[model samples]
Target: MNQHIQPPTSTASSRIYDILRKDLVGGRFAAGEKLAINALKEQYQVGLSPLREALNKLAAYGLLIQENQRGFRVPRLSRAELDDIAQMRLALEGMAFEQAIVHGDAAWEAELLAAEHRLKCADMTLDKDDEWERLHTQFHRTLVAPCGSVWLLRFIEQLHDQFDRYRRLGPKMPVIRQELDQQHHELVELAMQRDAQAARTLLDDHIRKSYDVALQCFLEHSG
Candidate 1:
């Protein structure tokens, strides 16, 4: 009699992938830290197959780096990588926002305002409140949802995940965060008014502010 072989289940793999991705984005693992397979199995209480599947998916998403001989490790932080992600976001999201403003209807405006409201009600602290993190992601996605470009949305999401890891793991500065909500309010007002150029400029400056904070944190920590 031949032995029976069971293939990896998609449900298990997908569940583990979501869980692991959340952990990675939440900065559960330190940069350049080696991920030991057996230890992870014990920690996540998952079988090997699903864990490996999740890890490979994460690596493909640029959250992890797969070594040639060794296994996977979190990507190391650098100024170059950080700046690249920031610049890409500014260009891509700026385009998306401008198009969204041009194409957005009353429904789009309603949803964007609602998302802003929800996000403002949350803690709004990077890495401090999980609810805030989720709402913030939703709010930004709503801003560009009317852009009507699948590729643009997809790329923006990937870049967001990459940049958010740095935001969550880096040092926090409360003093610099005071103006964020005001910026958000102004952005919503501009979008509602259909001022594409002004909105784009504001959005550009908004992203740069976060980039500056992330850069400062990176420098201080890496110094």
Candidate 2:
């Protein structure tokens, strides 16, 4: 006899939280925009309790800020914070690249090649899809998959997520895609050849360029 499997029930609070989080990170709820609970409840068709819970959860993630006596709003992206994050990302991701280069074997190389192919295919569209973003993220993750340190990879993943909020703004910037595609191709070449130093340098430059452009655009628009 075959056993029946059950799908897990989706919780309203988590669903509401995810929707708001996506909108916030996708730059839909622009920085410092007020997030009224009543409005969200009406918009999501949920009650006040779930809405409050969702907002509180997002506050913990630094995406939303709660003001005493006021309410929640999208946190403003500050240049200082962006720079600090970029510095941390450089250190972590650079180390990961080094480890992957030194330790990755044939299987890892094959996986990297497959991921690169998927990324190239998904990136063909000018209108970026969430699916393409997912595949792109997987490609980067696979590039560093040979690194043995779980803690370091976890930290790097968190930083990547934080940087993603700013990355959503990338499409609006002219020439960003062409520059990114070139950098990615170079990175893949260096990695495949086991040139750790060149890969690390390219990775660092790639991370910083996007951060610099995004920070400048954000500042100009906000100012």
Best by TM-score: 1
List the global CA lDDT of all models.
Answer: 0.86, 0.80
RMSD of 1: 3.5
User: Given candidate 1, what's the lDDT at residue 136?
Assistant: 82
For model 2, where is the 10-residue window of minimal lDDT?
Answer: 1-10
Q: How many residue pairs clash in model 1?
A: 0
**Tens digit of per-residue lDDT, candidate 2, span 52-110:** 87788878777888886459877777777777778999999999999999999999988
lDDT of 1 by residue, 26-92 (tens): 8898878899999999998889888888889989999899995449998888899999999999999
Model 2 score (lDDT): 0.80
State which candidate has the highest lDDT.
Answer: 1
The deviation in Å at residue 223 for candidate 2 is 2.6
